[model samples]
Target: MAPLMNRSFTTANTPGIVHIADSAAKRINSINAKAASNPPQAFRITVDSGGCHGYQYVMGLTKEINPAEDVVFEKDGAKVVVDKVSLDLCTGSTLEFVEELIGSSFQVVGNPKAETSCGCKISFNVN
Candidate 1:
């Protein structure tokens, strides 16, 4: 069978998988292209406390990957690596590039396990 390549698919077909938006994949690919580093950096997602909603989501670019501690998901040549700990809270969500009036940024939306979230989008309380 041919492999899935340079494509995006819906979550309905893959339970427990965090979907990546095309905008996000493009953004990551653009960033990595500029960096031009080996082992190519991947977008990293982490969850931590200290925010209006008690917990918060953090995203950044990283070249280091601890296989034992992280899970990497890729789409359209872009990669997203999440710590196992955070994945439990954000599974079934979508990683997206959001452009708004205030500013544009990457965010996680439609988190099935999140009970509540702040207007800023980064702050949240997991269910």
Candidate 2:
């Protein structure tokens, strides 16, 4: 078995940082409004080893805060949080919300460190 290879990100100096696109912010704000309680929350993003590629992204909404573990990004009253480990793979990436005929969702775009990405756009590989 191979050890888990933890490749250091170039943006290590500024870890847990992510960029939010305008469309994403708008969508997040709308979602927050629809929440009946504990609204105006943050999107917490996580990455783990999975998918046909080496990594996958996960996200959820949260009202809780843990200063030691999360880095936050904000725009137009919307907030996003990326934990240290996930940020290593996500730093300098743009978070966008897209609406397609199939459905709509938030996605990571412009990941400079990814060598190749799956057709689904949810998985990626790095050198």
Candidate 3:
């Protein structure tokens, strides 16, 4: 009998640490391009507790630097920085944008730390 071998997958050449939809990326890029005068110092993504599911996603453009923040991924002029506390909860996650009839929003997909998420898709529960 032959022994089974495990196969591992890696993301080495992936374009961005946070994946943006084509439409979303185009919009963000357009906005970023116009910021040449005073471009964003950095983009920050954080996880907080408050949502019905016990966790919420927060994102913003930051000018102040936090020495303790952990940089998870950056690509295509888009950078994603997560705090040490959130890093453990966001490892191996991909950021995505979704446009629907109701609205458009940025969401985290394939989060290994998430055990379940709300129907609205705005929050998650960590395992």
Task: Please provide TM-scores, in order, for all candidate models, with all chains considered together.
Answer: 0.86, 0.84, 0.71
lDDT of 1 by residue, 51-107 (tens): 998878989999898876777788977888887788877888999999889999999
Error of 1 at 127 (Å): 2.6
Model 3: worst 10 consecutive residues (lDDT sum): 1-10
Task: Report clashes for each candidate as comma-separated counts.
Answer: 0, 0, 0
Checking candidate 3 for backbone clashes, the offending pairs are: none
lDDT per residue as tens, model 2, 70-112 = 6667776677888877888878788999889888889998988
Off by over 4 Å in 2: 1-13
On lDDT, the candidate that comes out on top is 1
The RMSD (Cα, Å) of candidate 3 is 9.0
Assess candidate 3 and give its TM-score to the true structure.
0.71
Q: Is candidate 2 or candidate 3 better by lDDT?
A: 2
Candidate 2 vs 3: which has more TM-score: 2
> Which regions of candidate 1 deviate over 4 angstroms?
1-15
Error of 1 at 58 (Å): 0.8
Highest TM-score: give the candidate number: 1
- Worst 10-residue stretch by lDDT in candidate 1? 7-16
Per-residue lDDT, model 3, residue 107, is 74
